[model samples]
Target: MFDTTRRRTLEWLGIGGAASIAGCASQAPTAEDTGASTSTAQSTSTPKPTDTDRVAADPADVPDPISRSESTHHDITLTTEEVVAEIEAGVTFSYMTFDGQVPGPMIRVRQGDTVSLTLENPPESQMGHNVDFHAVYGTGGGAVATTAAPGEANGMEFQARYPGAYIYHCAVTNLDYHISSGMFGMIVVELPEGLPPVDKEFYLGQHEIYTDKGVGESGHHGFSFENMANEQPTYVVFNGEKYPFTPDRYGTLSVEQGERVRVFLVDGGPNYSSNFHPIGNVWSKGYRDGSLEPPIEKHLQTAKVPPGSCFVGEMETPVPERIKLVDHALSRVARRGLLAEIDVAGEERPEIFDPNPDTAGSEDEEGSAY
Candidate 1:
């Protein structure tokens, strides 16, 4: 089925590829200078098949929590590269990434630890790049210290003085363009003892993509500065693509019942905020804005995480069900394509939730309620 609602949203905003988009065919500096490859296709609402790669970082690819008791030194390296990847089955976009993934990789360290970070811009890169870490106490958060032009490398050392989760992103010129294109990630400076243990943990990033093309248009999409300025994102997504963690896409994030799960969410929004909520569950303990301080809030239904911020929340999966992670903005979920899912596999908790109490244990040939 076609997405009529999204189409209406475009119409209401007068966003059209040929008419309203202010920066039609205007690519980011890197994509433009490097002559990024794009398929030639007729603009249609229907998706066109693309051979491009995917940029969404696997939600399960989070670094293990710190296990050390004392402060230590760590070495980190981040490479800046531009990749042409698929936002969906048929649509492609050039993404600026820190190690070829959206939101890059999670950097984990103990509080008071010293970190030596290297930022590398390959010779083939068409633009300069640097990182501004929120956890750093230094000016520009090491942005000025690690600015690297193409074919260059820069390094800086900083101490993780505070204990909390923080965001790190490209802080080069036109950072909004770069961040919206996928150059952001999270860093966790944990207390000396580290965070409480949990059965599982997942890492995710939320950001918006502004393109001249609307939702389902085919062909390679270009970044739109005008749309970004207007704060009218063509897509608001988790990881890199719309509904990347949903069952219909890359498959739902799996968790067993009776387990406690931790989610580290980094909001990389160049604009807009995330009203993070987990359907079918609540944040049993939420560290507001990624704060690691004790006395975390309890039973938070939705947490409002703004741009360039982070949120760490825990959930208890006591029953088998599909819990949807969404931006409670609702319209973003319905139109802008932002969603994730957690599939809890275990016995049902009929005592808690029952959809068909009348049928009770009765089952049909399919082993489902009749």
Candidate 2:
């Protein structure tokens, strides 16, 4: 039944050609046909990638929390580069990224800190790029001052005036195209007192991939302008790949029981809001829109992280189980490949949840609640 539903969904999207619906073929839409920039060399498909072509950013690569009370000035530099990398085992995409990684890098600072940021567009870049930080108080949120063309460098300075997690992304005229192709990241401004410490922290970014090829296609995929304009994404993935942190790809995010964990998520969605939820657990504390202000919501089953927005959610791992991080927009997980995992390892508490016990033989053998 699930396969049948998935097939119908793909067919509705005009995904694969007639014969390539359930399966995939080594073919992709042309750049000219899809309105993708030619920088990625998508005119011709390439063979599957080697180790050097994997571009998914590591989830564990996060900056430590700000521990100081005094404000300070920081210098930050980001380079914009266009690269073609693997999106899945058999699929590839042309990504316009900051520092050559999706969602760029996390920028952390304390409230009232001065930030001098530089954006460099290398000579090899095919499109101009700039950053518009949601935390900045300036023209276009510093986008106007930092718009750099190919081979040029632009700089701007701003004071982190608020305490919140903010999203920074390309603010060019074609920002939707760039962001959907992987050009956004998070900027965390810590409060004066800073946030409560957690046993573990994981940083992740979510964005839709608008590709010309259908899901499961075994070749290079090109950016689709029509799809973007229609807000129909081919894949809604985390960290630039389908189920990137799962055991099948990169290993799961492991932690011990009874530990408190915090996840910082920035949604780079040029379109589509993420119904962020953790299966088998609830957000013990959720800071919506990434605000660390008082009156934090508690015990949320799901939280909406909209496009161009952010979320900071905390979880209490009291039991040993694999918690699945997913967008409650069910189809996105069932079909479009949006998934992450948190593996909690500890002894099972049968009193809380028992898979099998002595009561197993008490019910009717041939009857179920249904």
Candidate 3:
């Protein structure tokens, strides 16, 4: 079933003809480009492991992705769990997820709201896990205050002092490995006045998974530390699987033509950066790094969404078409599994786009000649 659905969607999107339509291109900054040193050594400063006692929380129970507190004070709880799931038709990956899902859950709060968070590592987990919220303004971005080993729980309180979307992920000794294994999420701190109203909103996360087996090898796969260190990934995917946002699979994101849509994207890539682009559409307003301040870029064709960062973009669909959302890195789409679709259903406007062009029958020789 999965293979059939994926192949049909790929054919419909013309994957063989063109990966994506031409658009404004932007380069994402890498460690070398930004003059930042990449750390390869594991931490040895922490104390040796010892049996610690704490209440174990159920990893399955977590807040809904769209759930939010109406009051000024909010309490959030996250539990770490390790589970094996299929990445594609016959490819399996052992994912370390927060609340048992890749990209964790979307946390929404007001700018001035006080948030109390709890990090729980279930006993079944083999390693320790912690969370560092980019929206926090404290030590280690609240990682130090909430690090918990398996069978333990830790809590901390912080104020959402600023308004923006932020990425949160494990900050353990092997931070990169943990994040690449699907331990990350986003927190949106809305401004007091809130954002502009839109007809629809969607949340997605992009991450690369490195495994010993090659792409589409079709068997159980294991994590490859060597590939991770070298920044080579077997799969670069949205949500958790290949071609999830297709009509036959999980279902494409649907919106009516002429409706305004917003997309909140968090890149959990422990490695490669995401050149986020919506083929066949343009971002009327793009808030880089989830910033809502002034100087929002207008009519952007693509924007760079770095690892551990968020991006917010809005679009106005003028015609009925299937918009293909991608990283804009052609190789990733052609080789690795990275693709999504947004289906805009409504009456087509031939004035804007003619479905059938009469090239052979047209009398204008100059314009019709191809």
Candidate 4:
């Protein structure tokens, strides 16, 4: 919902109209040049947005913080370097990765475990890369342990100190170089066993892709000296790949009716924000960083998830519907890159659309821009 003051300012500045027109004109490239004179100037960049969407885990998801730990060990290798991933079809660019996926791997550990990780940040730029787990209360949780040399692993030995969903991103803040480059991820601590088993669980995080390769200090290539001073990013994505990148045929979470699904969503924007929208399903319970509030029972069109946080969402699928997992920062939906899909395949019911009717004007923005 926009206020009158904001609407008046946009009208005076012609933001909505100009954005609409410019969006259309940007697609004039093909069409055999219909005799119309074209401008060579690229449209001015939209100022980077500070406000987007954010979410929190439910506290009820946390059994008891001081509870005993079952004590287990897991080896997670944190590596950053240029690797090629097909973000867009037929277009594989040098992208920084952790074992190869953009948002890194699905890191899950029970409440009581000693997690050790070997961070192999390949020598991309001269700058170093390191891991900082927000769960650690001391040594700034590894911020002091950042290393610049590639193949030079930044290793750490730490126990699960928190019970909720905490963030794990680069703490190196020189020009926000670490995050802007691609060195970031998430950390979720689960309750000691005995809770009901999840039918299926998945991992996802949000960030911007600045270069042709990807976003975050975790990219495969170094920023051009000319671009080092520039901050306008080109694409935003979920789990490191852009939308349509997860085209219907490629990336998707396939589910069926009557299935209970749990999504472990961790937001690592370290910048913008995110609005998690699961089209067609109303998440009844929201675990704010493992802290469960009374579940948000209403049909939610958009849910906010701020940076540096995580949450768990439980949804019971009653019928089939095409679900869009988007960063309701709608601009991010069409352009910024954080768009993914879920195809609910199965039979339908007459009651499916009544509770969450498709509103009058929820059309997503249209664009072919990266």
* lDDT, candidate 4, at 293: 35
lDDT of model 1 at residue 163? 91
Better of 1 and 2 by TM-score: 2
lDDT of each structure? 0.81, 0.81, 0.73, 0.52
By TM-score, rank the candidates, best first: 2, 1, 3, 4
Candidate 3 residues 128-197, lDDT tens each?
Answer: 6678899998766776566666666776899999989899988755667778878999898887777778
- Compared with the true structure, what per-residue lDDT tens digits does model 1 show for residues 76-132? 999988887788767777789999888899999999999999888777776667788
Please give the range of 10 consecutive residues that has the lowest summed lDDT in model 3.
Answer: 17-26
**Residue 197 in model 2: lDDT:** 95
User: Candidate 1: misplaced stretches above 4 Å?
Assistant: 1-52, 359-370
TM-score of each: 0.85, 0.86, 0.79, 0.66
Q: What CA RMSD would you report for each candidate?
A: 10.3, 11.5, 14.6, 15.8
Candidate 4 deviation (Cα RMSD): 15.8
TM-score of 2: 0.86
Error of 4 at 307 (Å): 1.8
- Model 4 regions lying over 4 Å from their true place: 1-69, 84-86, 90-94, 122-127, 146-148, 173-175, 212-232, 290-301, 354-370
Backbone clashes in model 2, listed as residue pairs: none
Q: Model 2, stretches more than 4 Å misplaced?
A: 1-52, 361-370
Worst 10 residues of 2 by lDDT: 1-10
Cα lDDT over the full model 2:
0.81
